[model samples]
Target: MWVFVAAVFALLYVPLFILAAFSLNDSIIVALPFRGFSFEWYSAALDDVDVREAVGNSLLVALAVVPLSVTVGTLAAFGLTRFRFRLKSAVAGLVGAPLVVSWLVMGVGALLLFSALSIPLSLKTIGAVHIMASFPLVTAIVSARLIRFDRSIEEAALDLGALPRTVLARIVLPQLIPSLVASALLVFAWSFNNFTLSFFTAGFETTFPIWVYSNVEHARALPIVNAVSTFVLGVQILLTFLVWYLLRLRPGGRSAAAPLLPGLATTERTDG
Candidate 1:
């Protein structure tokens, strides 16, 4: 079991280790041969104006996508979980269809829709597509937690003269903070790394992934892309640790945090 787990982790992270190593390679060509180490590519990536612009565009879209997708998804989750309607199951299926569908197919379909409506493609279109693609996951995450909630507590609160909106804002949403935070992180990463969907929907606005795609054809740009990717990976690692530490500080502590940072969380069983 340990060997299998080790192999799986190696498969997941070895490429990242190699990418980080190559980012320091002195040669522009991204191939093996143990080139002398240098940090020039990192500086080059920072100095490149196109790379900077693409980074800004990707960051802006991702930041925008997190809130929009989570808001839409959380609302959908509430509708599905808290309300009864004739089309509830059908609506749930429709919301979740994107999870099973191919991103390429969705992107192409979105392109056709935008073109038919004569809506010019831009970062807005990319963000719209990302929201459509990712909101279902948020719904799933929040719905699962909502289903497990103690309905009696909410009922008791309602009996105490709490407004419906107040219960939602002060009770339901507080309990679901971990789910919301996890969903936001996932949405941000998905939006930032997405290429195929963004490629189809983007007009003149270039994302970081798009910039890398366009520049990868040239040998000189490979190391720079590697450097940027390594930097991104480092940031993600730091953010993950930060989130875990903050979760540990929450009132419920690591037990509450286990939902999002399972690897860093611990649980104990007691019998009385």
Candidate 2:
């Protein structure tokens, strides 16, 4: 089983490895045959004003999308998990509906919607769509964490006369820090790498992925494209590792401090 999984992963990533390797090759043509290692492509990509601008645009969109998605998604997850209301299940489904939709379809739909509203294709529209695409995943991640959370902790704090804000700030937020950070990192990576929405929405402005797509059409620029792609891939892998590390650290595990609510950890405690 492990061998089969490893083979599948190799099949998936081998092309990326080739691309990264060729990015460092001195040859302009991306064909095989050993070429001397060179960092000229990376230097060229870094020096290109267009590449720098695209990267800046992507960074701006990610910066806008991550915080908005994480904040709203976390609140929505808490509401859906802890409260009951009319059409609650329907609302949850709506929140997650984008996950099943094709990005192409979503992009086209967003384009038409914006056109109808007389909104121009720009960074704001791109960032909004990215947020919509990412928040569903955030909701799913945070919801899973909230589902397994011990609600008794909140109730105990409330019973002990702790204000709701204090309980949330001191206890709930601490427990949720892992999920929140993981979700934020995942959303940032998603926004940074997003192509379809950015492609459709970016009018005069370009993002890194869109810029790569445009430049890759020119065969001469393939090496520089590959170099930039390798850089983006490395950053994404780092973010993925951070997410994994955050999730792997068990929340509220074996800490020296006492429980948030006094006596709540005792065996005689009865609140569920």
Tell me how far the alpha carbon of residue 146 in candidate 1 is from the true structure, in angstroms, after superposition. Answer: 1.0
Local accuracy by lDDT, each model: 0.84, 0.82
- Candidate 1 lDDT tens digits, 69-113: 999999998899988999888998899788777888888999999
Q: How far is candidate 1 from the true structure (C-alpha RMSD, Å)?
A: 6.2
* Weakest 10 consecutive residues of candidate 2 by summed lDDT: 263-272
Best TM-score among the predictions, by candidate number: 2
TM-score of 1: 0.88
- What is candidate 2's local distance difference test score? 0.82
- Identify the leading candidate in terms of lDDT: 1
lDDT of 2 by residue, 122-221 (tens): 9999999888877887788778778878999999999999999999999899988877887788778778888887888887889998898888789988
Candidate 2 versus truth, CA RMSD in Å, comes to: 8.6
Model 1 residue 201 distance off true place after TM-score fit, in angstroms? 0.3
